[model samples]
Target: MGAAVTPHVVDSHHHVWDLSVRDQEWITGEALAPIRRDFSLTDLLPEARAAGVTATVLVQTVTVAEETPEFLALAADSDLVAGVVGWTDLTRPDAADALARLRQLPGGQHLVGIRHQVQGEPDPQWLLRPDVRRGLAAVGAAGLAYDLVVLPHQLPACVKAAQDHPELTFVLDHVGKPPVASGAIEPWATAVRMLAGLPNTVCKLSGLVTEAAPKTWTVDGLRPYADTVLEAFGPDRLMFGSDWPVCTLVAPYGEVLDVARQLTGSLSDGERAALFAGTATRVYGLRLSEGS
Candidate 1:
């Protein structure tokens, strides 16, 4: 018999941080205390390898200016990290130059995208800011994708941003953080379809387990939200992300992967391949070698 084919897995979203190096600042409250300590790429390597993840996108955890460069250095040294989605002050007048400088830094070749915590912005339409728009244009000009970490309400602006820059790829993180715990899908579902209508947009099937009631969340609890994105964006535009340590709040890294498998079980092998690796490889312009 032919050897069983091992799926080529690319974890599209995950993060690493070291408290000794810098503070997360966002991991506040008792609920987030479990992950208060340091989480490094060394810690994630085994977990990822065990789960068949050959490559991963190391994402930005905090908005600190230094974090991106640090992450780039880490990615440069590690075979597991194929890409880095780091943060930058989009509102800065020199946003374009800032991106260019980041590219010139050590390990900067691994830099595939840029992200800001739009969820924390006080204004729902924060993406529409003039300076931010210019920064986004610069991102497109740099030939990099943009990762959107926004709440459901902010999706309309994401849609507008994607519409405005057809040349740029906007990856919607965590299915736009749907109200999975509440099981209320209307506004989120509606908004997701609108965002998916734009050809330049892609969605990550991640963070749903944590968004659902942590202890009580089952595969069924996450299906609707997953289904919404799968239907709206299709498998070619959807990718899997472990969400890692943050997902540890609700489910372990392995459990998160299992849940994703269950949610996408019905898809054909090629479709599942797209969700597991192909989409991310294409969207981030990842250059993986044979068997990676």
Candidate 2:
């Protein structure tokens, strides 16, 4: 708990995208314009260095089919990117082949997992679909994981999906995005507990800072969900993430880590290290040197 187990940490979640290359189609407001300009390895590394984050996992920000190789190429050129969780169509018949193609791309060795923005899907059971289950199985067979980026309401489907494929690793992003902004918890907490009961699933202690009043959220604002996830998933299944640039929308990168440290102050040293860095390294197969 002393000083939050400060280490030369690894930020397990963060992203870099360029709208000039192709419109993200997700950044639609002035609040998001700073990122729309261009966020690449060059833009992220300095900030990460200044904040003491030595390595990062570059996550998928767009759902486009081609973005995986684009992210892989970016990884090949940088040391900061320790792993890449790019995307592929999980619903396609050739989903397994598509995943194989992504691995052949440059820097694809850095590829650790597959993610489709399940939160964007209108049908809650989309993840539970038979074809989607086949694709997830393929990912598991290939020794890759699947990340669950879903809304709170989608937790039931996520739980079903996780149980349906116990061999596939599943990561829950943003604390399943609880309604901390509105102070509501009932069903979200219930569903999250259910999802956590699955042995193959883990949750990211990230993206919560932006879920509250950006300028005003305190450790208290994040505490309930953080504590719940800690209790539900325990140290082994929970990992830290910065959720950067998007975090810039609410708090700076350091502040996000600061809050994470503060909320987890009661844990043992090993637990803190796991949440802050160890778990991510194991979960993502990050290639780290002493410098990283």
Candidate 3:
């Protein structure tokens, strides 16, 4: 008899942090108290393996330059981490040079994409700034994708940026972070659809659990948002991401995976496979071994 092929599930987004190394200033409020401690890859591997996740993309948590190298080194040593979406000072003039330096470092081959906390920026058009646009150009020139971690209102800028940098693939994280807790989807939905209209853009079906009402979110509550992205980006351009540690604020890692599975239950086997693995692998250019 022939051997059964294991499904190669890829967790396209997730994060880890160490408190002793640096303080996550954003984790100060009581609402984020539960996850204020160190969350290392050691804490994630067991959960990921149990969820049938063969590989994961470790995303940057802070905008610190030192953090990217640390993440790349970690990816170099781990079999589970297939790629890294690290952060660099995109506003700096040496953005391209910085990217080149990063690619030459240990585990540099795993640096698949770059991201900045555009969500935290006060300016909605931060991505459209002259300096940021230059950085975007550098990102594209370096043959790397840019991960957009922006809020709903900032999606318009994301659309414009994608249009301007057609060479760069803009990955929209958290489906542009919809207002799921309020169950409002007008502006967010409209903006997401516009962003999805760009062929160079992709969306991640992640972080929705935390966006919903704490401790009470259901798959049905997330259906509309998920459906919006699925229909807008299509399964081939949409990928699955756990958004762990942060998602743990609302649901456990296993529960988050189960919710995502339920939300995508109606897709065909091939479509589901694309969402769970194929899309991320293609977008990030992840290198996976046989059976992984």
**TM-score of candidate 3 versus the correct structure, residues matched by position:** 0.97
Once fitted onto the true fold, the runs of candidate 3 whose alpha carbons sit more than 4 angstroms away are 1-6
Query: Each prediction's Cα lDDT score?
Result: 0.91, 0.87, 0.92
Q: Write the per-residue lDDT of candidate 3 for residues 1-292, one digit (tens) a residue.
A: 1212226689999999998999888898888999999999999999988988899999998989999999999999998999999999989999999999999999999999999999999999999999999999999999999999999989999999999999999999999999999999999999999999999999999999889999677778999999999999999999999999899999888788878888888787888889999999999999986757
Residues 169-192, model 2: lDDT tens digits = 898988898988787887899999
Most accurate candidate by lDDT:
3
Comparing 1 with 2 on lDDT, the higher-scoring candidate is 1
Task: For candidate 1, write residues 1-292 as lDDT tens digits.
Answer: 1112328789999998888888889999999999999888889999988888899999998889999999999988888999999989989989999999999999999999999999999999899989999999999999999999999899999999899999999999999998888889989999999999999999999999879997787787788999889999999999999998899999888778878888888888899889999999999999786669
* Each model's total of backbone clashes: 0, 0, 0
Steric clash pairs (candidate 2): none
lDDT at position 167, candidate 3: 99
lDDT of 2 at 201: 94
Q: What is the C-alpha RMSD of each candidate to the true structure, in Å?
A: 2.5, 1.4, 3.1
TM-scores for candidates 1 onward, in order? 0.97, 0.96, 0.97
